[model samples]
Target: MQLSSFKSFPLNTLGRDFAVGDIHGMYSLLEKKLVAVNFNPQKDRLFSVGDLVNRGPESSRVMSFLGQPWFHAIKGNHEDIAIRSATDPDYMDLMLRIGGAWLMDKSPKEQARIRQTFTALPLAMEVQTPAGKIGLVHAECPLDSWDDMIFLLKAGKQDALHLEEKLCWSRRRFKDRDETLIQGLHALVVGHNVVEGMQIMGNTYYIETGAFLLDGEHGMTLLDLVALKPV
Candidate 1:
């Protein structure tokens, strides 16, 4: 299936909307936290900030979550690595070295299925919330304006490829402590940067609390887009 480079979800008028940080394959931990928060799949929707697989124990279960109707996600850099490794021999070592060794155990057919799943995910997505529109990208939004980012991603040309690199892999915003907000978005949520907690710079929020890190010090973060409180 050819999915768009950008996707937009209408407001969840029926129930609540939640956005989680880089899950990194801690499927059980995520589910436990979801139950703690009383996440009702029957009504609420869960938006993932990408990095759904890798670095953690349960990466194999990623496909099950992907199949769930209520779960939505964007493409993370690890997903990019896994996709490339499936086709290009050069990327295999990189993928295995960086918490993706679990993929090696899968058969060629299973690998292909996983690759197709990640490839189908868009680089960026937005959800309409009662507060306004919230944007979700794996790492950083390259452009200052959301509209420009969407247009460039949709074009999928040479320039878009460069932007895609920044979208999936850039850390300039978090590294430089950039406080500039992207226009046309009420708030932007991103992962890929393992912040101490949910760091709010301008309107952008970094919510990945290193779920993959087994050190008791770090855990997952799940933010309510409707309420948008850091947790």
Candidate 2:
């Protein structure tokens, strides 16, 4: 909602600014990690690459954090589905199949609130941090050119799906990523494509840890934008 992009929103002024990995119902794990980092919510802030719901228990609980001033998230593929399936039965099967089963039990009012929350989420966010200028997207950013990706994003929705949907669902940029780089970008952070851990390719960082798998080794990958390291 902050016009998709922002500049000079430096983290130095805050307690500590962090970009968290895809939180597929890993709220407790995220809390633990934040505690470990000594995150002071009163002064700190968090930016999420969406997918805050689905594929894990307590997706509903995650919604509680959305209202807090310290938290922000972009639209994720799972959220895209949740919004679509809210009114259209066509997406119901796939939505549940991909971790939207929680929606099935929600009251109509609760479901509407969730839909409203997600529908308001931007497809991407760009900010200037102490580390550098960072761009956060649910999936990929045009590794070849940020201009190409921004063009599509600013133009808004499409016929079958919005440009945001394409951006939120893409994984193509990661293939052969060794050869890829976003010229002037300091870091283009993303989730959606789960990895063994946080992997950096050129200036792009892929941090989806698949916390929903409930694997002991997997949890949210919190990027310390202030320190430019994973916390």
lDDT of 2 at 226: 55
Candidate 2 per-residue lDDT, tens place, 1-231, comes to 235432225445747778988887777888888888898889988899889998888788888888898888888888888989976788888887877888879899989988988878877777777667788888876436765666555654322334555568877777666547775467888898888888888777888987877545456788987566787
**Candidate 1 residue runs with Cα over 4 Å from true position:** 1-3, 158-161, 214-218
Give model 2's TM-score versus the native structure: 0.87
Give the TM-score of each candidate. Answer: 0.94, 0.87
| Candidate number with greatest lDDT | 1
Which pairs clash (backbone N, Cα, C closer than 3 Å) in model 2?
Answer: none
- Write one digit per residue (lDDT tens) for candidate 1, span 57-131: 889986689899899999999998999987688788888887898888989888888898888898899999989
